[model samples]
Target: MSIALAAISILHLLDLVILITSTAANAWIVDGDLSADLWYKCTSKNGGYHCKQSINEDWLQAVQALMVLAVLFCLLSFVFFLCQLFTLVKGGRFYFTAVFQILASLFVMSGAIIFTVMNYAAASSSYGYAYVLAWLAFPLTLGSGLIYIILRKTE
Candidate 1:
């Protein structure tokens, strides 16, 4: 049980880190010298990089909001998990933590799907590591959430 608890904690932390990195990274899509992220679009030219704010598109804005919300929920879930670990009764389950984590996964999945669908026409460019990270976070969060649901406060 101790080993399982530690593993879950590690997974939750990893998910949070990946969420933060994916949200902050400026490489959701890359094409030659150009790269774009939720916040900005950057281009490399003449041995320098020029960055500009991302376009004011409704979908992009939605993605940004969802990603931020996901990170926040993940953080909240982790905190709640720690609190419940100590305060919860021996037989009680981590329902609150599980719900928050599941919500976070949903948010991540929604944001990534929106980005993929909106950018489908831009086949010339390739999806970057940040984009992949966003996708990767979805399943990990969901799995952790399910695990939390099954976990009980055991002595």
Candidate 2:
């Protein structure tokens, strides 16, 4: 059993978990940021922020649902990766497994970048480390992905 292969799988799992957490956390961040703005804007007049205590329940719920689904997908992806990794250990080329793994990383990086851009000013209020891990993880994820592709069996 190649230790490096298992390590790669573990790293993939870790990235998957991070993606799930990032998704779920994004919902809270969005709600919190919006809620805080609403709170202050309610007190401060003159069209400063235009926030209200009674925010859009539908939008909030929708975002929450999206977060749940995103997390679920990430979890499922990890599970599938584990199964695939076990099979690859026995005798299998890193095929779709690597592709999916890379895709997951891409998803999270894109999500992080998008969130950072969307909440650019949130730093003043909250929304910390918008592009922190994504920036670092992107290249690592991409490099690992390329390694997997090159290591894959041609047959």
Which lDDT tens digits does candidate 1 get at residues 32-94? 999999999999999999999989999999999999999999999999999999999999999
lDDT of 2 at 90: 38
Error of 2 at 126 (Å): 5.9
Report the C-alpha displacement of residue 45, candidate 1, in angstroms.
Answer: 0.9
| TM-score: model 2 vs. ground truth | 0.53
Give the per-residue lDDT of model 2 (tens digit) for 6-74: 776676666555544444332223333243321122333454545444344454344334434444554
How far in Å is the alpha carbon of 103 misplaced in model 2?
1.8
How does residue 125 of candidate 2 score in lDDT? 55
Q: Candidates' lDDT values, in order?
A: 0.96, 0.49
Candidate whose TM-score is highest: 1
Task: Supply the TM-score for candidate 1.
Answer: 0.97
Q: Quote each prediction's TM-score.
A: 0.97, 0.53
lDDT of prediction 2: 0.49
